[model samples]
Target: MFIQKKYIINPHFMYMAGQFDRNAKLCTIVTELNRTFIVDKSPLEILNDSIRCIGFDLRGAMETAKFLLGNKYMCPIMVNPIHKICVFPDKSSIHNDVKWFNPVHIARTFSSNQQAMIEFTNGLIITVPMKLYSFNHKLQTADQFRKMMLSIEQDPFSFEKDPRKGA
Candidate 1:
């Protein structure tokens, strides 16, 4: 366990959960490579800082997600598209309690007691207080967003042509 005044997200980052400490003070739990970082900032702030630290803006990422997927809310963001670093939130970032999870770091997810249980690649499991269906939907949405971004990056100008047409 360690305390960090500011955090820059990296490939090893697993998730960022906004939570209240023992004193009921707002803080964020950042998990990276099985290391815990108790950040004195909200999840949104941490995300924005990380993005900006890498020369990207939070709004640009959100807008891109929305434009690509037509998502109105809770859209996943690709913090660094070149590195394929994408993450999605279970709820609105402004919400007092929200968790931003990187899909790449997640090993699996299961439903139990109507809630969603996340299993990290490191074998850590934690239950989230949200409907399993909703959680799964969010995860799928994030996956979709990531795929779209990757496809675009791989061939932004390439287009599919029918062989029968003989282009």
Candidate 2:
């Protein structure tokens, strides 16, 4: 119902896709915990801005994820590790039809005809144009990525160097 000029991807943001309608071309469809709105920017634009807001750019986020997930395609991006807002794209990021989803808020995904259906924790259901098996694989990867990040951060031995940087 509401059209926003810009948006940041946060914990409340469930998923965002580039939707084409009469009023807008490839506008971002942002679904949050409390509501869904339309953003004038494209999905990638929103993602880039969101990551930059937290002191990094989209390429940096993707490259870090790719490095950690070597040989794994469709890597899940950890936008804000402290906030636990990680997301994975359905298609390649260069594709205009890509849809980014945060698996944390996803209740479940099931097959519907030749596509997949995602049920959000907030009871929002949307069909994705992807095979059930493929969708599930991506979801599992995102889960794994999130777990790995949390484990590394929460490790008991994690500590900064005691001595001064120059010393």
Candidate 3:
């Protein structure tokens, strides 16, 4: 049995998009098995998974539609049926991608701070943060997240203290 878990860095945290920026929002990070996977799931897939895994029990599909189409919180980074990545850009960098879909419109459509959603080649849809947390700090921050990711990428068994016992 392959155990998978998701770790969300509540976008409300300042460290998500580097330092010296103020735009407290919630960011979600999906960590599964040895890989620190990002969220690339579609809005509809995320909604359904949230309901299925998190037991959201949304009122109904209509309510779900309303929720997704009512708020401009999460910004869609890239969307193509196969994969997508969204990010909540800081106020200064918001204008960088003006040609793509209107950030405001994307946000208004989904009542979530999530900014990215991607679908893996293996049929897994994921969502990820727009800007990754920087690699600096005494406390284990996203840098550690990156390290874990690299470690897994290099030698997945290295990080596992007890592979058989499953810690």
Which stretches of candidate 3 lie above 4 Å from their native place? 1-140, 162-166
**Full-model lDDT, candidate 2:** 0.86
Off by over 4 Å in 1: 21-25, 159-167
Candidate number that wins on TM-score, 2 or 3: 2
TM-score of 1: 0.87
State each candidate's clash count: 0, 0, 31
* Arranged by lDDT, best first: 2, 1, 3
TM-score of each: 0.87, 0.87, 0.19
Question: Global CA lDDT of candidate 1, please?
Answer: 0.85
Question: What overall lDDT goes with each candidate model?
Answer: 0.85, 0.86, 0.29
In terms of lDDT, which candidate is stronger, 2 or 3? 2
The superposed Cα distance between candidate 1 and the true structure at residue 105, in angstroms, equals 1.3
